[model samples]
Target: MSGYEKTVLLTGATGFIGGRLLLRLLDQGIKVRCLVRSAKKFEAMFPGLDGVEVMEGDPARGSGLSEAMQGVEVAYYLIHSMGSARQKGRGFIEQDRKAAENFRIAGEKAGIERVIYLSGLGEHQKELSKHLSSRQEVGKILASGSIRTTELRAGVIIGSGGAGFEIIRYLVERLPLMIAPMWVNTRCQPIAVSNVMDYLLGCLTTPETAGRILEICGPEVLSYRELILCYANIRRLKRAILSVPVLTPKLSAYWVQLITPVPNGVVRPLIEGLKNEVVCRDNSIRELIPVELIPMKEAICTALTEVEKGPGGIPSRQSCFLHSLT
Candidate 1:
């Protein structure tokens, strides 16, 4: 399977990370087939892009997936169940498990050679949050099939329109004085969205990534509290953060709902997940990809610029800003 000759089937093509990867692949003359739920919505977002194919399907239902996997050399599984809470009930873990099983069966039936999955970084299964646990479980389900699986576990993705960045940005911009939960003190390693895309694209060509569970992150590590302060300083806003130890996840979610635009479902999982420190434990991926990571300040600046640009989308030259920094 040569890099230039592979036909990659990408799920979650309209998502924050997936959308960026799709454009990069297309630009490199890689054949990309996207599995999207709504063709109309996909067309609305993409609006006449050449050299890409879209197949209408739902990964959750296992419908229309087989057709999309046909003749696929490598399939990128970027779909997550966070936004599907209402439709799948409050326990998203079970929903994720079922979806992964379906995807595995479909991939095997279609003879998919490799399956690349993007997941979250967390401790061992016993100490994992429901969200992080579900991500790991999904990786296992994908590997159960004969197809080789590459699981890239990442922490908060720093990019405009990304849920993590949105939360950090809104908190910094909206509050002059904040009463944050103790989880804010937990350490996290964030990777720029462009860096994430770089690893994803690298997996397509790097056979060493197959059958490996790799953790990816930026050059620096900081506490969630420090991240908020950094963002505040970037925008030149005066702010004071007070971390309260007694605030439970439930209480924190409610407070976030009141203070920010983040919904309860999204905020709840995020808050629960933030209690654990999320720094990379190994540098194996660095050896594999061999690209210098973007600094935190530069990543935040690029994210802010994208948000201010009205989500009309980032220009191609701007898409790989972090790549040049590397």
Candidate 2:
């Protein structure tokens, strides 16, 4: 199928994963319309990009959704409220739910062919953490819509600008000896950003992926403590972690804030979620999308390499296209 033949609507274009996916779609020559709250900002980000357009809209506020979804074939739902969860209090949950419902209605009304959503991986039990629960709930809401939905539940996404990776980066780069909570022992399957994007793009062409709840994760499963140690090792920094039961989630968040670029609000729920074992429960996505998955160490190395190049490491879509031409 020709890229021009496929029309895709993308949400969270300003976010880490969405931003990368935007470039990928443009590179593949796919027509993309971004649902952004500020068209000015979006335009500023991709001034001369071709085969792409921006629709001014807000998903959380439930405005401009219908107009944004008009005539789109596939919609990528990457919006989440975790960033504003603390500021919104418990109301963030309701905000996320509302946004999902609005997107569902808009997509259904627009007759979208497929909706691809990136969600978190966790046990479907009452004991799931609030953050994980919200992720899963959004998946459910999107799946309930008239269109077929492909919800990819991922663990910690290792990337340059990702929140989870930032937390790991700061903790390792700043501290040599860490007083960690017991949750540090919790195991998670971390996938590289490139691999995640491949799976996401693969979903667009893989008709069998629709209406499926797929788990995309790294080949290696390691504890949070192990990941931190791995990060330290890659930097050639000797580190030791003393896992203790005394540090509460709030205290851990404050400690993280002191060391990391992340704020206390965003880190709190993330820290709390470390207790849940988030390794992949299923791996059927491998056969569907045969991209070679990056290992934890290699993923960390790539992320660090990009980070070392400064904020401009990740190129804008227009810049990428220009570079390709050169």
Candidate 3:
């Protein structure tokens, strides 16, 4: 990894995917500056981790970003929020818009060379939910800047700490007989978190990856019910799902929040997004950065194993799992 480039600015390093990416970047001997809301909190999480510079910043408010973005080569935008729905179920879209604008301005001023953003995958022609639209909008804003940007649009991510997997975990484990909404039949392509990590890490050294919009996903397309049953089969839990037309997305969100550790603010928006069939529209990423895409059953098994490890798991509880669908 010698002769590598200069420092890279990483946002959302405290979250599930970002935290893991932090570890990967450090392992590769990349110089990293993390833009976080709290320096103390970041240090507390990683303890004695070296080679990382922590700066306090809120991109939405444009605080501390001018300094954070200064002299950085590339940046990772992983700051998708489920908590943004804290006010009247319509806050996240506006918050995301503002944050992207702020980041674009800061990066442009700082002369950042590139930005790699992970966005939600869905056809724009299909009336996208608020969640998916917000995700894509952020990508658009970031790319609108002078800095070249690579946006990887992903569907349902299958991992322990991810909202999509955790919701499925709780639902299948707790309910032997389940009552669900019609969205349960909606098909989605579920990619393993490991495969996601591979693609992300690959983007770092692959200069050709810059300024591209790559749609990433797993090998199989299955309904939400199939995902549930796959988890059940993996865990040896007997489960049954009856898809009724009655339960609205809001009701389903409440029911899920009651069972899983995921909050209602996050669950509501994620549930609304489930209605859209999310599969990779483009497969260009496979040739750009090749990695063995893990199967749904294996992804389920790995996630369960990580959860069994408690605080020492691969995706630590401290890392934010604020993914929209995955």
Clash count list over all predictions: 0, 0, 3
The reply for model 1, stretches above 4 Å from the true place, is: 1-3, 85-90, 311-326
lDDT of 3 by residue, 1-326 (tens): 62456888999988878888888888888888999887887988899998899999988778988999888878999997667432344487888898899999989998888999888988778899899999999999999968899999998898778878888877777789889999999999999998988888788778889989998999999999888887766666678999999999989888888888777777888899999999887898999998898877777767766886756343332232223114
lDDT of 1 by residue, 125-206 (tens): 3487888888989999999879899999999999987888888877777779989888889999999998998899898899
**Candidate 2 local lDDT, 1-326, one digit each (tens):** 23446678999888889989999888887888899877877777778777787888877777888888888889999877766632356555788898898888877887887999999998775388888888899999989967899999998999998999999887877788999989899999999999999999999988899999999999899999998888777666779999999998789888998988776556877887888899887899999989998877788777877786666443222222221111
Task: State each model's C-alpha RMSD to the native.
Answer: 3.8, 5.5, 5.0
- Model 1: residue 281 alpha-carbon error in angstroms: 0.4
Give the residue spans of candidate 2 off by over 4 A. 1-4, 85-90, 312-326
| Residue 1, candidate 3: alpha-carbon lDDT | 65
Which 10-residue window of candidate 3 scores lowest in summed lDDT?
316-325
Candidate 2 C-alpha error for residue 59, in Å: 1.6
| Residue 88's lDDT in candidate 2 | 50
Candidate 3: clashing pairs of residues: 15-320, 16-320, 157-326
